[model samples]
Target: MKTNYLALLSLISILPLYAQQVKFEDFFTDQTMRIDYHHIGDAKSELVTIDQIYGYGIWAGSLLHLIDNFNNGAYYYKIYDEATGALIFSKGFDSYFKEYQTSDAAINGIKKAYHESAIIPYPKNKIRFALEKRGKQNELNEIFNVLIDPADLYIIKEEAKDKDVTVIKALYNGDPHTKLDVVILGDGYTSSEKAKFEKDLKRFTDLFVSSEPYKSNKNDINIYGVFKPSEESGTDEPGAGIYKNTVLNTTFYSLGSERYLLTEDNKTMRNLAAFVPYDAIYIMVNSPRYGGGGIYNFYCTFVSDNQFSDYIFLHEFGHSFAGLADEYYTSDVAYNEFYPAGLEPVEPNITRLLDKNNLKWKNLIAPGIEIPTQWEKKDYDANDYIWLKERTAMNKNIANLKRNKAPKEQIDAAQIEYNNKDKAHSDAVDKYLKSSKYWDMVGAFEGAGYSAEGLYRPMLDCLMFSKGTKPLCKVCADHAAKIIKHYTE
Candidate 1:
């Protein structure tokens, strides 16, 4: 028998492509499935239990990219076909519970339960769902596993809540499965403020597509706005003793950080977001407060009327969409130690720089550039410390004024004073950074990921690192492009 070597080579070349082409119809239907669970735990221990399974809506995720190649987030959920035991779908996501576990309350052993959900394509048959948490060294360890029967009568199949919610199609490129679909939801916008929501949505969508990577790939993206009115017109501000009857219950002062805006009402948020096909969720709060928050693959929130609203929207979306880590270390944060001492973070933007030769962004580094690149850290930190102190003091003063029922004019005056000082400080910092010899270089810069000494960022000034609307660093931008390709290609 004669064996044709050319045919053998051709077969070998196409085998991997065939394996990568996982047919959607073979394993999944066109519907979507959401598995709601209660995440209960503290700093030391955690547990997950099923709350309810929901079936509705069309799957907006890509059929070609069934597996998450990017190893991000604190937790990953995987689905396996029960009959063949084949891995079918998987995604990495961070939850509010994960952040809470790092808080002072969790460190003191005050356990809490958070409602979380994992959305996936509806399975064709029974499947095994496994939830894994990242260990200290960043290795995934399975913490919970359950076999789910899609045909079970217990699975909720009723009409989705908020089905009548108004949806604004801000941008429509093409099919959602072929484009990166982003759903924007509004909180604290009353029925009378529907026009305001529409205007805000248009402004944000335009700004988003105008940015670098998104601008270059605007034809491969879709933006939708899902608006369900709230009774009130502002979010809760616990630091100022102000509360409102918002739909999503978004609040400031989350996890002890005055500017950290987020919501614990995950169920309500998910329900409202279900009105549109979404690869990402953005909740725009109707407030003028300069506060916002983002968690990887979970959701991002920003107040709609802040002066830095545009920057916050882009920065938070970077975290929620591409899992970029915060690169500033001078500001105060609620977490005790976000990135462990010796461990490298899963985020693409920041690293511990454990090995100079094996640096994560080594390929992007220019020739003759030094690893752990040095800048004016001493001088920068000195100025930054002074600014941080003043900012904290100003925040406290404003909060007190609000609590004491001070005159609106007085509060506005204080805010205006702080805003002017803040602008001056920001300008000075930007100028100081621009004067660096390595200003345009892509080498590891010290002081990132909320640590002044150990962790490092790829560049000096990035949207992740500063307050202004600076563009993403080369490494960060490349990662964003890669993620965009994952959804659209």
Candidate 2:
């Protein structure tokens, strides 16, 4: 006890040095530097070039924890003081560009560009910005580097919006730095629909903070909304050939996956998001299309009026906030071989079980739980694979009918048959999943991260595993807690 007290005193003495007076404020202002760039790539090659730099509004992230400890996202970037050669701000992130490169068109050497942006604290001196991306085997390779001068005349001095937009304080605590700052933006809502955006944003955020880790850590969060109205409502539907005059040209059928909704309008989206100091961005498109997208440390999207909006929001937030992966493997995603085999995924929840003794969430396993956890996986997968085949077949047919401009009657008929078949499949999956056997175990369960063969999840049933009413799995929930601490602690 005496020795323990002495160690505590030693830690207390060194704490002041770690929190030195010449800390974050000495090198950075409270404002944000929004660096916009063009990410050009094909499956064979990829690179980044600076497009624009702006002095955005206040910086809302943690001043003390300048370095991100959570290893997430397909890409990672860092900011270093050129004068002192000190790492200042760093983040792991993903983008639509990275996702696009995995498409079949990209493998055919169809090169393209995606507008991307990152927000950091406004530096007082020259800084070196570097970005590294995770390659095929999860190896980090430096892809882009730039020298930034805060006083450079080329750095544009602009606010978040060109035209006026209402900034609603949906949920605000005292200061942003101590809280996880989230800014919600709406696409495809008209000026008159601003009220609806606010209401919907409020509804989802309330639902968001009320979920597992967020529910227990509510006061540690701040929610803001940027209400940008479009001339017309509803986003684009390329499969159905419907386009609208929305600022952020959000679209469904991204990468030919009908439900994988995302936007290539990164500049416009980031522009509106910077209206408020935000740590995370959520874009709610005004459509009932049952679609959304989420990238780690980037942003998450959801359809505003979908019947499954609540569930979708939670699932996507798990990706965007806690960097959790989709444990469900049965869905047909555009990502072909998304998580490469043999390499352990960095997501907190899912694992390849390369080292059964050192599973990612090994500490969270309940006592006596089997390592390669036993569940009704053989029975579950047998039924799940069948359901996936039917679902994919139905979706492919619908997409084809839409692309060919089939008559409304034919389309309706196709959808009716698909719906009835879907109901039957859903019931079978539920029964297969409802067995009480090993449901509460924390051992690794096979089939996760879009793979049925090698990948495994930490639990049998979870929000990450399914759209069922279960909370996030133990591993996922613990990650959420760690993320909240990253911002608030």
Lowest lDDT 10-mer window, candidate 1? 1-10
lDDT of 1 by residue, 1-489 (tens): 013432442363345454366678899998889999999999998989999999988888898888786999999998867765556788999989999999999999999999999999999999889898999789888798898999999999865556448988999998888999999999999999999999999999999999978999999999999998899999998889999999999999999999999999999998888888889999999998898999988999998987789889999999999999999999999998889898989998899888878998888997899888988899999999999999999999999999999999999999999888887887898899999999979999999999999999999999999987678889988999999999887
lDDT of 2 by residue, 1-489 (tens): 435533543463355443233368878998888898899989888888999999967778888777775778889887766665556677888778878887888988999998888888899999878898887778767688788999999999877555658898888886888999998888999998988888898898889878899999889889998887898999888777777899788888889888887888887888788788898988899986678989888889899976567878888889888889999988888876778778889888888898999888878888988878867778777777787787778777887787788998998788778767765665566566667577767888888998887888988888887753468888899999999988886
Off by over 4 Å in 2: 1-22, 135-137, 161-164, 396-431
Q: Report lDDT (Cα) of residue 287, candidate 2.
A: 87
The positional error of residue 453 in candidate 1, measured at the CA in angstroms, is 0.3
Give the TM-scores of the predictions, in the order they appear. 0.95, 0.90
Candidate 2's error at 310, in angstroms?
Answer: 0.9
Error at 278, model 1, angstroms = 0.5
Give the clash count for model 2. Answer: 0
Model 1 residue 487 distance off true place after TM-score fit, in angstroms: 1.0
